[model samples]
Target: MNTEKTSSQPAYEPGGCLTAVARGIALVVVVPVRLVWDALGYCLKHLWRWVLAPLARALGWLIEHLLLIPLRWLWEWLVVPVARALWWLVEHLLLIPLRWLWEWVLRPVARALWWVADLLVVTPIGWLWRHVFAPVGRVVGAALAWAWGIAGRISRAVGRALALVLWHAVGRPLAWAYRVVLTPVGHWLRTYVGRPVAEAARAVRAATREVWRALFGGPR
Candidate 1:
């Protein structure tokens, strides 16, 4: 039997073993380092937003405070007074013709209103008060006096009788009741009658004054 030469596979190289081990170790360290570096980059990318947020806010505040604030301050402290003075000068100087025109335009209406007011409020008030209230007041006084006189006479008669019969204690109360009861009623009647009488007197006085002013003269 011819036996073929059998060759054992070459022994594994030691350097190859070392190189593989080194490559494994390098892979192990490199993977973790790369992972850590990627995580750091992600964290920094996100952290950039948080860092710039406060700086942006601060810059906006600086623009407002440094620029807008001074401008508004100057406007308030200087511009308002200057504007008002210029406006007043223009209104009083340039607007005179307009004022004259406005007044002339309104003059006839104003005169009509003044005449009506004089006739309604002033002339009537003065004339009616001068003539009417006096006479009406006298009439009311006379009526009050009449009622009071009658009441006094009645009370005196009753008092005399009651005193003679030793009932004088009741006389005082009766007299008081007579006065209290009749005074308000009589006054109320006087007020009711006096108001219309006074108004009528005012109308008459006003008419008379007008007629007299027309016929004779306004005043003596």
Candidate 2:
């Protein structure tokens, strides 16, 4: 008799068939891209290291030796000396004399002018403002206040007199007419004419409502 044995373990499942296929495709595509990128990087690295770097260094050295050195020397020797001499000349010849003139002549003249201006303009103006204008303004203000008080008193008195006259002339007569004449007349009219007219109107409305109800079908 021959016997066969079967293993009873679960099979390994790393994702599924789709994931494996996708991984295979990714590897196939990425290998060439990675190889190309590496080759480009290597080439660029060597190119920069050997060719571009040397060229840049040579250019920098040439600039430093030829252009920069000469410019620096010119600035240090020619430009600096010329600038110093010109500054010295300006300071000695022009600025010094101007400074001296300003200190000795212009300053004193300005001071005298200021003193004269103060005496002629500022002092007189200050005096007038303090003595003349201030006193006059105070007096005018006092006069205006007194006149205002007088006017206010006169206005009050006039207003009282007018009120009294109006009360006697117009208000008292109107009050008497309303109280004595119009009150009796209004009461008589309301009693005789208004009551009769109101009663007649009520009768007419009641008759109209009755006629409408007789013609139409509605609640009585």
Candidate 3:
């Protein structure tokens, strides 16, 4: 009787091809965006509160007290005397323009609204006389389409003018409110959320620094 010898199985390489492929995919998908965000977060932690925030506050204060205040007084000082002198000179000039503008602006808007009302309400009623309410409704749709085109143009012009007025009237005041009145809210956010985050970041940075110091043999 002949006995056959059995061969031993070869050992598998741990984390061979599939592991490399998964690692490559992770590097490609995850690293760059994560690095960028982390860098920004790090900078915000180390830089923003410690550096730029004070500058922002200082600049805002400088703009408010140094620039805006002096300009306001100068404007009041110059405007009063000039207005008195040119009051009669430009009285007729301004009166005509003010009257014309006030008269014409509302007139155009009223005319547009009236035209729309006649087209929609009046013309639809006229169509109802000839046909049913369905046909009248169809005519109203077409009239509304025409009115929309005209209204769109007029509204764009009005919106631009109104935007400038709103910007000048409300923008600075809103900014001031946000800077001054909202300070407590900002401080609360910083105290509750931001301070903890910064503290965590400081811990992380310290740990990273220690790790780097160990590996590279230098202080971070």
Scored by lDDT, model 1 comes in at 0.87
Give each model a TM-score.
Answer: 0.30, 0.63, 0.28
lDDT of each: 0.87, 0.96, 0.88
Question: Stretches of candidate 3 above 4 Å error?
Answer: 1-21, 24-39, 89-220
How far residue 105's Cα lies from its native spot in candidate 1, in Å, is 4.0
TM-score, cand. 2: 0.63
Runs of candidate 2 exceeding 4 Å displacement: 1-69, 206-220
Clashes of each: 0, 0, 0
- For candidate 1, write residues 114-151 as lDDT tens digits: 99999999998888877998788889999999999999
Predicted structure with the largest TM-score when compared to the true one: 2
lDDT of 1 at 25: 97
RMSD (Cα, Å) of model 3: 57.9
Instruction: Give the range where candidate 2 is weakest over 10 consecutive residues by summed lDDT.
Output: 1-10
